[model samples]
Target chain A: MPLVDIQLIEGVFTEAQKKGMIEKVTDAMVEIEGEAMRGVTWVRVQEFRSGAWGIGGKGLTTEDVRALTS
Target chain B: MPLVDIQLIEGVFTEAQKKGMIEKVTDAMVEIEGEAMRGVTWVRVQEFRSGAWGIGGKGLTTEDVRALTS
Candidate 1:
């Protein structure tokens, strides 16, 4: 089973967006692994509090993520 | 930076237990990599909904996890 865990800044995604992400991530894993893995694939979305998630020595906030993604 | 994600059955761990897990997992990553990596280490503990997480063709519930761990 391939378990995918995605971490992002809190409040960046709505529930619908997260659901889409889970489906797409699982699909990607199934495409690479095999169709049999589809039933066993698990995707978890975790939102980190501001200042808790850091990249390149800088903490990421929702605004930072928005700017980077948008 | 190493990101460690732990997946488990929901309701299996208390807040304190999860906190301890986060600390230990981060420490393990740091030990394997180096001391400098500790600052950027991210440990996310995810609890999957019952009947959603499967292993070896069987779904895992809190009771199953408790039995296995105990």
Candidate 2:
């Protein structure tokens, strides 16, 4: 079974986007693991509090992530 | 950067258990990746709705998982 966990800063993504991510990520894994594994492929989205995600010794907030996106 | 994602059936674990998981998983990765990488190490726990996780072509509910534990 392939388990894919996606972490995002809280409030950064809409529920629709998260659902899309789950579908696309599962499809991507199935592409490599083969279609038969789709039933066993698990994709879950985990959200961290705004200041809990860190990179380069600094915690990142939703604003930080959104700034990078734009 | 090492990212560790743990998936569990929702409502089975307490907040403290999840916190402990994040700590232990992070330590487990640091043991392999080295202490310097701790800052970049990310351990996330994602909980799936009961009946969302599947194994052996069958969807597993929270009770199924709890049954296995007990």
Candidate 3:
């Protein structure tokens, strides 16, 4: 069973976006691991507070993510 | 760097429980992968909506989880 967890800054995505991510991730895992594992694939989307995510001694906020995505 | 994600039914665990799980899971990964990986290990505890978790043709809800843990 492949469990996929995606972490993102809170308030950035809609429910629809999260659902899409889950479906796509599950499809990718099934494509790699085989169809037998499809039913057991679990995908979760977690949101962290703004400024709670750090990378290379820098904390990232929704503004940082928005700048990149926008 | 290893990312460990734990999935559980919602409402069954307290914040402390989830934090404990994160710490223990991180420690487990570090124990197997080596000490250098400890700093980069990302552990997340995800809670699914009740009745959202499925296993072997059965859907598990918070009630079922509570029953088991109780």
User: What TM-score does chain B get in every candidate?
Assistant: 0.84, 0.88, 0.87
- Candidate 1: tens digits of C-alpha lDDT, residues B34-62: 88887777776656787778889888888
Best-first order by TM-score: 3, 2, 1
Error of 3 at A51 (Å): 0.3
Candidate 1: residue B12 Cα off by (Å) = 0.8
Query: Model 3, which residues run further than 4 Å from truth?
Result: B1-7, B12-70
lDDT of 2 by residue, A1-70 (tens): 7898887888888899999999999999999999999999999997876644544324566898888887
- CAPRI category for model 2: incorrect
lDDT digits (tens) for residues B1-70 of candidate 2: 6766577888787766777777777777778888899888866666788988888888898888888877
In model 2, where do residues sit more than 4 Å from their true spots? A1-7, A12-70
TM-score of chain A of 1: 0.85
Candidate 3's residue-wise lDDT over B1-70, tens digit each? Answer: 5788787888999999999999888888888999998999998876776644544223466889899999
Error of 1 at A49 (Å): 8.7
Model 1: lDDT to the true structure: 0.75
TM-score of chain A of 3: 0.87
